[model samples]
Each structure stands twice: as C-alpha cells, then as structure tokens.
Target: MPVLTLNADNRKELAAAIADERWVVACLCAAWCGTCGSYRATFEELASRHPDKLFVWIDIEDHADVVGDLDVENFPTLLIQHENLVAFFGTTLPDAGVAHRLITAQTELSAAQLAAQADSSEERRDWQHDCNLRTLLGA
Candidate 1:
C-alpha cells in the first residue's frame, strides 16, 4: 500500500489511529524534494511488508502547521513511534537494506512490548528469539 498522507486536517485522526498500534513509521518530507521522492517507493515497499503498522508520509510543505511543532530541520526524515511514543528519529534513507533493517528492528521491539502486554509467554519468547537471531545475523 502507498504511505498514508498526513496533514493538519487529519493529524488528530492519524494520532488516534496509531495510539494503540504496536508500531508506526512517519516520514516527514516534501513533494519537491528529490530524496523524498526517491525514497517513496522503498517506503511503500516497507509499508506493504508490515501492513499492521501505520506508515504515514507527511508533506512538510503542505502541513507546516502540524509539523512546525516537530521542529524538523531536514527533508525525508524518519520517525518511528512505538505505541504513540517516538522511539526513533532522524534515521536516514540510505538504501532499501538499511530501511528494512531499521523497520525490522523497530517492529520487533514493538512486537516484544505487545507480547508482554498480552501476557503471552510463548509469544514473548518467540519475539525474543527472532530479535536475537536478527541481531546475530546483522540484519
């Protein structure tokens, strides 16, 4: 799926949508930015890989008011949110491999938290193993 476009009009809904979700990745970008345009395809691919997670693409120019509070200084910036909390930001869009690794890491971390919340020991253990293996493999 294409990255969901966010703006002042739907900022509240976007926040509410991601509030209880395990993970969300928001891309702060502008339409005229070449880098942002280039990264869109990869971002969409990642979003497709993890449909459960909210992938928001915000056009900084179009939604300056909403993003003004963020004080973002660069284009194509990435922010990873875990349960409505910003867990990571300023991660660069270097390449698809790097993007995949970052998304996988954040998703695994969020999954661990979700597993804990559900009180599923088996699920938690499985996530832990998955994380450990990913780390060991340098993914």
Candidate 2:
C-alpha cells in the first residue's frame, strides 16, 4: 500500500488499525525540514515494499497534539509500532539498509519476547496449580 498522508480524517481508523495488531511505521516530520521533504520518495518506496505494514507520514507541526503524545523531539523521527508497542524510535534514517535491518530485527525480537512471556505465564499457572494440589494433599 502507498504511504498514508495522515490527517484528522483517518486518525481514529489508523489508531484502530494499529490496535488491531497491524504494524505501523509513522514518520513524524515537519514541513519546514528539508530532510523530511527529501526523504518523502524514499519513505514511499519503503512503504511500497511493505504493504502489510501501514506507513503514515505525519507532519509534526500540523498535528502537534498527536505528535506530542509520541514524545518526538526531532524533525524526522521514525517510530515503528508493531501491534500496540513501539518497536523502534529515533533519528535513524540516513541509511536505508540499516533502517530496514533495524525494523525487521525489532519485529522478530518483539514476537519472540511476547511468545516467551506467554510461555512463562503458562508455566507459572501450571506451577501454581501443582502447589495448590500439593497443599490439598498435605504434602
């Protein structure tokens, strides 16, 4: 899919999409920044490659309230959100190869981390149940 020009119109739908486990790559930029303008094409190319991930180009000044909640301090801030958690953030945009690598690594790591958490929770529950059984049997 093409990079989405995020405005007030589709903001809620975008948030809902992200909340629904869809990965979103939000580029927080300002219209005044030359670099932001320059990277528009590159960003679009990246978005095109990853159709499953929603790519949103947000003009910081135009949407200060929403960007403020993101705690963006720089002009061309790249925030990658997978599901509800922010997977990556910072001013890493000069090298496209590095950016791609970082995003993919984060996505995989987040998946692994979540899976591990679920496994741990299941183990804890099983242990607790075993302990309860032991207590009932006076062991």
For residues 1-139, what per-residue lDDT tens digits would candidate 2 score against the true structure? 8888867787766655555556777777888989889888878877877788878888878976555444566656787655544555567754567667766776667577744533465443342332221121122
Model 1: CA > 4 A from native: 110-139
TM-score for candidate 2, please give it.
0.73
| Local distance difference test scores for all models | 0.63, 0.63
Candidate 1 RMSD to the real structure: 10.6
Worst ten in a row by lDDT for model 1: 130-139
Model 1, range 41-136, lDDT digits (tens) per residue? 878988888787778887877876555545456766777656533445664754777877887875676456644533455443433333221121
Q: State model 2's lDDT.
A: 0.63
